[model samples]
Target chain A: MNHFIIKNRKDVQKLSTLAIFAGKTMLSNGAETYRVEDTINRICSSKENIKEVDSFVTQSGFFLTLEYEGEIFTYLKRVKDVGINLNKINLVNDFSRQFVNQDISLEKGMKTLDEINNIPGYPKYLKILGGSYVSGFFSLMYGGSPQDFLPSFIASFISLIILDKLSKFNLTFFIDRFIGAFLSSLLAIFAVKLGIGVNLDKIIIGSIMYLVPGVSITNSIRDTMSGDSLSGLSKGIEAILSALAIAFGVGIVLNLKSKGWI
Target chain B: MSVLLQFMYSFFATIGFAIYFGAPVNSIIPSGISGGASWSLYYIMFSILNDKILATFMGAFLVGTLGEALAIKYKKPATVFITPGIVPLVPGAGMYYTMSYLVGRNFNKAINAGTEVFFMAAAIAMGIIVSTIFTRTIRRFKRQN
Candidate 1:
């Protein structure tokens, strides 16, 4: 079901705003340039607060940014947690970036989650599931090169359609994220090897984007910068450990390829 | 054509990538413009020193100074523009290439690449730290006043 809690107004707004920026940043693959602009825009919009707001992403364990008044924060993560959701983030970021050139209202873009949540006739649980799926798929295809993007775009759409058919199984989000990334990466790699012109590096990194633990990476950097070495070290350690987990997961498939077991 | 336009285009492309990565909108364009102008220092330094690294440092210093001015002017964080502007200098692709070479067991190539990566990362880090310290000192001075 839609987990719509009426948090105290400030916190709720903060959470939603953070989610929007996090989602965007997540998609951009944590490139510094995009992040800088994103922070400036967010902070500029929130002129009244003039206080520090820290945002953490759960999946990536990365801190997006720490804003005190209007300044953005930055640092290198102690760990890397590459995964499929990172793909989803890129796709969404691409879509938004495309719209950046269009005349669409930013406020409307900002309200996408709420709009998805309040769709009529769909079961609340179904709506949430559907929204996540759509969002995931949209994000995966958004940031790719135009020509190569078509197939991944088509593949993502097809996967979501197929996923919807299998939704009755009620898998947890984490399980689905793993399965989705695994299958997508599998197809993406095959597509690249089979005479398609897609760049392997882009495919691997793009698909893994969906699952990278960005929040943790950002947090690790932030804690370190703020002189809380222990907190930073722990956060950095956690991020590094997660990166190993992701590398291992991808490594299994790569190993199979090496062993002629694929 | 004007030298300024070249810088503007480069700056725009840089900021465009930054926005794509998830920077707040307000910071991207302005930061980019400022980043390009920051290169002016390097242009001037090249004329005097004729040294690439020294020129690079001078340019970066100017960019950092400009970044501070923008932050104060916009009443936003210095990082919003500074991070993205300096991104062009980050050794990301170099680091990736070094790691790839090491993985492939090309020891000679890897070592060469690795050294470049180390230097680049260190320089970038130093630039950031220097600017940050500069800003902090200014802030402290203001408070003392």
Candidate 2:
């Protein structure tokens, strides 16, 4: 049976060290799932006689579920030669350097979020619109079907326009969400009616990705896995709440449309 | 010629991501080259198998293994260099789009796109986890001797 399993605590520690290091890299680079998956693959392939591998990345981190179909002793000898150490992982360093950066004053934080909301003129809105348009174009170029691209483009454009015309106020977490989802639904309907052959799935999903909270969720999970439970919890909650906000925004717009309100 | 261009795109795209993510420009070349080679493998597998999931893992494995070799030589975290190389292949934004669309409306289209994203994620995750476990377990059994 060829598999990568840690029979003792030392091996577990070694793997953890690599995971912590890899988690840091994943967190910094927008915390995309692919990076996290790639890191796990890198770690597993580091050893010798690794035949037949499988792995999974959850919010928790990478867990290697492998099957070893190679000679045992030679593989152990190679593993010993790798010079991996559990103590060198610097759990504290990883947390402090990456996860601890979020301690900001409420005043400053709110102000920044406010600025993002309150910026006058349509240029910023158009910029977002333009980003969506290009993103759709790139998405199509990269193999998205026309059914996916056309509707998403219209939805993005309309949503941005609606967002632009809406009154800029001091944004609250909840209110921002309401506006976002409301506009998304409107854009979606417009796209649907325009006969652009839009797929509702494509437009809504593409629009939301611009602000999806992937990095935070990945980081929170990484922190918790590395033993920074408190920070991880906070970050996790933040990520989840933000996701909920987007969901709420999208939901409201959807519900409104069902009610024929807009 | 087009395949060659796609390889270059994957290669350059990986390098650009590496720099953007804080890797030095000096190391970017080797990293990109490795990533490009891996993507070439991916292109081959995807073309042959016509399975994006299989292609993703195989390409990812190649990139990761080659990246580990590079890390041993360079003494930096394999992730710093390897991640950028594989990222272009990961479907992050794609999955999110699928999900949001499902939530909004269009059940049929949403299900189609969403399933693709879900399977891709699952496939990638399974590949990484299984590979790691396989390596670790083999070593443990070897140690008993």
Candidate 3:
């Protein structure tokens, strides 16, 4: 086994660093933990001298081990602010597949990996427009009158801006969702109070739809069914926590209304 | 007319969601189609049969199937499309109702709404799983052949 270990210390160091980069990209971009682990394994296995690789990832961080030349190296990486960006996930997936398929040099691979990690996230205007579109259409689909469309769009747009601004504070996701949903509900209620919207409830619901963690919930289900139990459970908890946050925000408003406090 | 309205809204909504999630630009339309088709299927099945569970199940299955095909064609994973594509079917209204009723201290209504959300979510998940198995099996068979 040692005879086949042609990779020297420098090569092993490069491999470990490359693996860490890929792992960070995947974990930070909200890839399933098992997928992160799988990608790391694939990237490392591309090197002939890499003997064994094992990785464990959660929503928070990862512990990875690599063995080569009869020596084992371990690394721990912290993951934070895991947001969903499918484009990054796809590019990294493609890169990892390319890495495993052939003789891409370590330097070239690192450059590609850096590019994948640095690809710009969604544009600012796009986030606001996307938020408006989702809320507006969702309101209509949920049986809101045509009168509610513009109000829903406006409410969601404002909340999106607020949400983006709050994100810069590096607050936890719960606070982000809570504040965003609260603002959405408040504005929607104001629209209704002005006699412009027919269904206050529908508008509120539609606007707060932006706060729902649909992606996390859907991915958790897929992850669980795919047999990655811990990853599934962690993502499931994330989705549930976000849901609770949204409900908290909306509940404060509705509870006030029910009590004639507002 | 109502069905068409629902379809169009879901289509654009899914596209918007895809953008927000930063999905690949070229696959956005396909994801939109998946969302539109899922809503249309659910509407048809629901109108004809008055069955929410079966309707959502079939709808999610169609969305998953479409996502799986689009994933293969686009060289991306099925999840990229599926997550955004199924946004239209996530029982948003049910969740809202549950929250409102709970807030209002209407326990019975809250329970009703909550159960509906639970069932709908489960149906959607089951549908996706079933369709994933279908696609995986077909791909495996195709490779073997």
Candidate 4:
């Protein structure tokens, strides 16, 4: 184990930078705010001669301050494009534990963090298949007949492709979900009209399950219970707004169908 | 559908979501099991109790407890398991019905479905909180000894 010593201001700056980067990776990848804060503090305090470490993390950004050798260095990062990727969170959690226990050099730690950040998620085709399975099986679970399964799968598969395409344009998450939900319901209706599906409501429910804010809802409550009320409230609002967006999307299609417009 | 079929469907659905969310590959099956078991519990409870909110609470509680146990065993964070496990229980159907009611101009039905949706969400939150507290307390006691 290397004895990592903070010998100068430059080393201190490097240490703080590493901590902030790790925190950013976690936050943007949908880790809880409290976990982000804890990871940052643990990383900063693990090295030698660090006098103080404080980190404040919210849904949008984070601020970290570290004191070493009579110098206080602070880092503020505004995180964007928050998405859910549980593998990254797990990797970072492991990295922090390893970092705190072993004397890993600051530069080495930075390199490892970079590697972790660059790791790609599952391939597109598999993710598409995964999305289809989610919707198809969910319809069956929700009491949809076996005939509805293929329709739910087809609707969600195409809409997930649309969602993936729309995300490339860097649209806000709300619009992406709105369009996704709208397309899925429309497709579900068409499937029924074509006699490919027997139950429109079941198909619609299953297809739209892809857009529900399950992660945000769970994280919001977990954050609040852990005393990070700010993060909790923000995530709760996010969940509500996404739910509403999905509702509006599906509601419009259902309304059109009711009026025989479709 | 039989309980066995519901469990099987939820298992595959949970695995699909676990992959979509990029959970670690080794942890996927464990999460699937937890998701399947909890959804089956929810199905049985809803049938017997006929209370959506209480049934949801029970389902969420099972997910949380099982997730925590799996996290400890796999040496990964709990969120990896809990996030995917809870998806089947989220009130997606209620939200859809609520919107349809509003669009059909059935204000009373809309309000009724909307309130139940809100309460179901809260019930899920409460269930998770209680399970977390339960685990933490048990850990504390073990450490004290």
Least well predicted 10-residue stretch by lDDT in candidate 1 chain B: B87-96
What digit string (tens of lDDT, one per residue) describes model 1 on residues A15-71?
Answer: 445445535444224322233234434432343343454444332333444444354
What candidate 4 gets wrong by more than 4 Å, as runs, is: none
Assess chain B of each prediction and give its TM-score.
0.69, 0.77, 0.94, 0.98
Model 2: share of real contacts kept: 0.02
Output the lDDT of residue A130, model 3. Answer: 91
| Interface RMSD of the candidates, in order | 11.3, 9.5, 1.3, 0.8
**C-alpha TM-scores of all predictions:** 0.42, 0.43, 0.95, 0.98
Q: Write the per-residue lDDT of candidate 4 for residues A208-260, one digit (tens) a residue.
A: 99787878988998899899999999999999899989999999999998899
Looking at model 4, residue B71 earns an lDDT score of 88
The order by descending lDDT is 4, 3, 2, 1
Worst 10 residues of 3 chain A by lDDT: A1-10
Please give the fraction of native interface contacts (Cα pairs under 8 Å between A and B) kept by each candidate. 0.00, 0.02, 0.73, 0.83
Give each model's whole-structure lDDT.
Answer: 0.46, 0.51, 0.84, 0.92
Off by over 4 Å in 1: A1-226, A231-262, B1-10, B35-64, B142-145
Please count the clashing residue pairs in each candidate, in the order shown: 46, 34, 0, 0
Every candidate's CA RMSD = 13.3, 15.3, 2.4, 1.1
What C-alpha RMSD does candidate 4 show over the true interface residues after superposing them?
0.8
- Better candidate by DockQ, 3 or 4: 4
Q: How do the residues B28-69 of candidate 1 rate in per-residue lDDT, one tens digit apiece? A: 678777656654444456457875356555555655666777
